[model samples]
Target: MDNAGSNQDKGNGKYAGKFPKIAQQTRLLNILVIFAVIYTLYLAKSLLVPLFFSAFVALLLSPLVAFARKLFIPRTLSAGALIVLLVAPFTFLGIELAEPAERWMQSLPKIAAEISKEIEEISSNIDAYATPPAEPVEKERSFFSWFGDDEKSPELSPPQDNTNSVTDKIKQSGIDIGLTLFGNAPFLLAQVLACIVLIFFLLVFGPNLFNVFVRDFPIVTNKRRTLVLVDQIQRELSSYIVTISIINSCLGLATAGVFYYLGIDDALLWGALVALMNFVPYLGGVASCVVLLVVGLVQFGLTSSAFLPAGLFLVLNIIESQLITPAVLGRSMQLNPLIIIIWIAITGWLWGVVGVLLAVPILMCFKIILENLGVFDHWIRLLESK
Candidate 1:
């Protein structure tokens, strides 16, 4: 009877020790699940990106929807208004871009000719400045010899340059670009579908989606706190998108005006490019300036005045960036510029243009959520505590 009692006590002790081990295993399993989920997302990124875009747009439209609802507008009408307001402008821009882009494409051959001419001029200028290596003059004093020239009937010395010719370089560049654009079409189609679907769902059920998240988390028992966090996330996302669009639009209009003032034929095209680039933060400004410079160089000859259009673009950007944008987004996008640039580049790599544009809103949403969480809240402090 004593030995049996001892065995029973030992069994109870062993069972108690197993709980911590079981808990550890469970924790490991959870971590693995998280990693697998992330991997799965990466693999399905094609499907995810467009849906993500729609989700963001839907969030962006929520405040407008809410305001309309408050004004006694029906939900369907409000949704339609938001969709039209959002989608119509893009469609119009697409149409507008088509003509300019086509013209630009048509102008490529002329541009190529101009480039070649400029290159030849540059080579001539360089040669003019350089002392030519003196070739030994073979004095051939035949009756048919040049009146004062000692130049031999130059047997075409086997073509002096083995380096890729300029034409080859141009053709290679075009082919490489064509191949890349071709490769991405499938992903692009997926993204478009995802955005439309996500946006539709968001407009129809954005409110319910938030509620479901709050109410249905398996272990996150704090429903109200989660709801508040989710609400803040939506607000921040919407604020970013709306603010970015308005600022970019204003910048675009101003840029177009500057180009018009400069007598550029495609002012609207340049402006649209500037506006689109502005969505990309730091990198966009430099890229727009470079493109404008090239356009200037192409439209005008390589004379002293060839850079004026580019200069105009620079001036406009300086005014818009240093004066206007700062005042508008000063308090809002207080995230670190360097970090934002990095995130944009990474997302842009994974998902391309839309990803780059969406990076800011996504970051804002993340910062908002992290602010509400416990340890991850430091990102908020570092990003937004300004």
Candidate 2:
């Protein structure tokens, strides 16, 4: 009897131990399933990128189709006309900007040389103001020096003398310029194709498709609310794009005027660049300023003169951020600066400029979806009240 009791007790202990092992296995299985799903998504990531962009473009261009239909044109015909209209304007702008941009690129070397000299003068002026940096430094190497020749890739190292290695310069510049132009090319090409394909389909058949997609959605009292949410998102994003375009164009014009007055070469190019780039958030403005400063230095052979363009930028940036945007855009759709910066960095890191460009809209889409699902309503309410 005692032996039987002992065996029973041992069996119970073993079973309890097995239960924990089973739970652990279950947890691991769940984790693996999640990872598997992520991996699958990663594989299909290529397809998703283009389709996502196409959907966004479709959303933006939807109103035009609706307007065309209102004018008594067939919806399909309206969409086709709108697409051609968009393409023509887009191409025309590119062609107009090309020659000036080429001229600016060719003159970059001279501007860089100018900036190096002005930096030294600025240091002296700072000393005169009694606000000198703790470290006495002079002759900050111009940005152009960082890009080494093709024979050797520039090695990135902090130059003791404050001049970055030419190799380091090349690498960093490539990241800033090349990836956006080239890395995104494949995705952009795919996106363009998808847009062309979908635009016609949507124009001819969007009504049916939208109806089908919505048919199986949860039949709840909130269907109307859900639709309103979608309409609100579409309007907000479209308005945002239009507003941003206007603001950027103004900034570009202002940049051109300022630089031309300062006798900067290729001022028109710089202005156009500024206007176009400012469409992006923090990075856009900062990059244009950097490029402008560089161009000024190369052109004027001094960084002090770079200030004329820089000053214009500062004034315009402030106007846009404080007066223009706020007065126009208001606060309802405003995003948190902290989140914006972080997401920009993350998206830029993961997928480069294309990622950064899409980040805000992507987040906004997610926010709207969450709101529709009631997942973010509480948070949004808190945000609004505060």
Candidate 3:
């Protein structure tokens, strides 16, 4: 009996010793699985990106579609109409901006030359003031130089025949551009078409899909919880999209007005670009300022006026990001800035520019889901102050 009891105690001791190692292995396995999933997502971006984009667009427009349905409109027609309405303004904006963009492209060489000249002049002035003169030293000829022939070796010149004809160069450039466009056009068109179709179907049938999804949960409480979660997510995401869109549109209009007052060319284009880029958070504001600075330098040279547009843009961005967004979004949607930055970096790495733009929304959705599920409550609390 004593021996048996000792054996049992030994067995218990061995089990206790192995438990931590088992737990550690399980944790390591989970982390590896997570990394593998992320790698798969990165590899499958071509197939997944359009789908994700379509889902976001669908969610954004779902409320509008719902409202339209309340007025007795068919879901199919309402979804189709909403998509068209959403696309038309963008198409119009593109049409309006095309000529100005082309003009800017044509003027690039002139702008570059002016910029280079100004830079050179500034550099010369800085060198004159800030750099001290170096003492001149006499050089001594080597023995090899003394032994060489007095006559200088013939200077090498580029072969005149090797120079490309202007027409040939132009033709080659045109061919290269045409080939590039031809290669990518089909893929881009296909993605756009896929997104549109997916969005339309999702809008028309999203509720039914949700019902079907919840029905598969196999428990009544789970189904109800999922339905509630879905509704909450849709409402919150749609509200966020609407609020941000209005704020961005206002920013764009204000920017346009400022540029117009400042006598900048292509004010509308600049405003539209600003509004579009503002969707990407920190990097977007920087990009807009840089673009304005470049345009300012190209248009006004090195004068004080060259700084005005960029300065105004920077001020406007500060107001919008610091004041307008917070007031509009309120504390409910607030997130840790550090976490947002990290999320942006990770998604941007995984999916490039689109990921950067979508990171905040995706993070918000994730937080909402996890918070509602009551999992990782402490982590979620840490991610938000309120």
Q: TM-scores across all candidates?
A: 0.77, 0.68, 0.83
RMSD to native, candidate 3: 6.1
Give the lowest summed-lDDT range of ten residues in model 3.
155-164
Candidate 1, residues 218-264, lDDT tens digits: the string is: 77688887767767777766776777889888888988987788688
Higher-ranked by TM-score: 1 or 2: 1
lDDT for position 321 in model 1 = 72
Work out candidate 1's RMSD over C-alphas: 7.2
Tens-digit lDDT string for candidate 2 (1-386): 99999999999997988998899999999999988975664566566556666677777888788788788999777878878887887678778877776565544444444444456566557656875335533445578856846444444443335443553555455445544555666867667767688766766687566655565656544666756776787777777767767877887888788778877777777777787777567777788777766555455554477566666787788788778876877776567766777877866665555566777778667666666567758766543342
* Predicted model with the maximum TM-score: 3
Best model per lDDT:
3
Candidate 1 collision pairs? none
Cα distance off (Å), candidate 3, residue 142: 9.6
lDDT over C-alpha atoms for residue 38 of model 2: 59
Residue 304 CA error for candidate 3 (Å)?
A: 0.5
On a 0 to 100 scale, what is the lDDT of residue 137 in model 2? 36
Tens-digit lDDT string for candidate 3 (1-386): 99999999999998998899999999999999999999998999888888889999999998888898899999999999999998898889889998987677556555655655565666668877986665443345677877777756544443234232443444455456546655876888888889899999999998787787678756556677677778888888888878888888999999999999878988998999899889878878988998899888877877898888889989999999999899889887888887888888999899877788889889888888887778998878888953
